[model samples]
Target: MVEANVIYVLVAREFKKFVRDKSRLISTLVRPLIWLFLVGGGMSRLVTPELGMSYMKFIFPGILGMTILFSSIFSSLSIIWDKEFGMMKEILVAPVSRFSVVIGKALSGTLISVIQTVIILMLFPFLGIKMGLLSICYAVAIAVLLSFCISSLGIIIATFYDSFESFSVIMNFIIMPMFFLSGAMYPVNKLPHVLQVITRINPLTYGVDALKHVLLGDSGIVDFPIVTDISVLAVSSLLFVAAAGFLFERKK
Candidate 1:
């Protein structure tokens, strides 16, 4: 009960911070929009129908992944800010278990990422991506799981960095490569043998593939099984959360 209360308080605090940041909310939405309208639009011209669908529709899932990826990682920056402002020490010295704090932060980040992805989901009608009710629900489920995995990863990354500048550098270096290797903008199988191996190893690849499977139906573009994607995400989320908790517990 005590742990639950601790988690609840911490999660609520994170949500309050998110709500009060109007500029952050707008920027999050704007970034994905630019990718969808400008980048996707330009690429659509060169992408042939033989690719199975329009480039805009094909990249929708990837944009969703991008939304979660950026939001989850940036949301975790709050941890560093807290540490710098001395708020983290206060929380760390509290009576609550470190595990609860980790869980709270992960949940808070997941919630924020999921919310951002849902806003992108709302753009499906505009993009002509037709998903049934069941498919939409499945996409949301996958988004929540992916958000959790990414959020936990952010926490793990945050544990090692104290400054936004340093963290941003690491985040960009890691996040950009993860997005490109994720098969979000292209089919994984079409890549070279070495790139295929790399994409398979990237956790975000599974999330994007899973999203494509749900949103695109049995389209030949996504070669991975949905179960495999979900299983990978579930295992990754657990591992990241465990790592974050271990690091948080050891922090002075």
Candidate 2:
């Protein structure tokens, strides 16, 4: 119960901070909207999807993944901020277990990411994509799973950096490759043999694929099986969370 409260407080605190940061909220929201319209519009001209959906419609799911990807991963930047101000030291010395701290931090980021994803989700109809209530629920579920996975990965990476400048450099190295290689903009199979393999290995690829399965539905584009998407995300999330907890323990 105490550990649960730890997570609860962490989540509450993070969400409240997010809500108060108006510019942060708008910038994060705006990026995805820009990508969907400006970038997606341009790419649609050159890249007609064989998936039976318009290119804009096809990439909508990927845009949501992009929202979650950026929000989820950067949400862990809270850790560096905390560490820089010495707040993390206080948290680390608390009576709660290190695993509890890991869970707390991970859940906070996941919750924020999902909130951002949901905000982007409301734009679907404008793109001529209709989502039933069931589909929305499924998308939220996958967002939660995917967000947790990315947040765990982020926390792990943040542990290795003590400052924002160094962290931004490494994140730039990581974020773009992960986004591009995840097949967010194109079908994975169209890539060269090596890239196809790398895309498959990307966790974001599975999340976006799962979103495609849920949102697009029976379009028969035939990426990974939905079962494979869910299974990979679930297993990878566990591994990521456990690894993050271990690192938190060792670091403190």
Single out the weakest 10-residue window by summed lDDT for candidate 1: 163-172
Candidate 2 lDDT tens digits, 191-220:
899989888888999999999988888686
RMSD of 2: 1.5
TM-score of model number 2: 0.95
Model 1 ranges off by over 4 Å: none
Tell me the whole-model lDDT of each prediction, alpha carbons only: 0.88, 0.88
Model 1 TM-score relative to the real fold: 0.95
In the predicted model 2, the residue pairs found to clash are none
TM-scores, all models, native as reference: 0.95, 0.95
Show how many residue pairs clash in every candidate, following the order shown.
0, 0
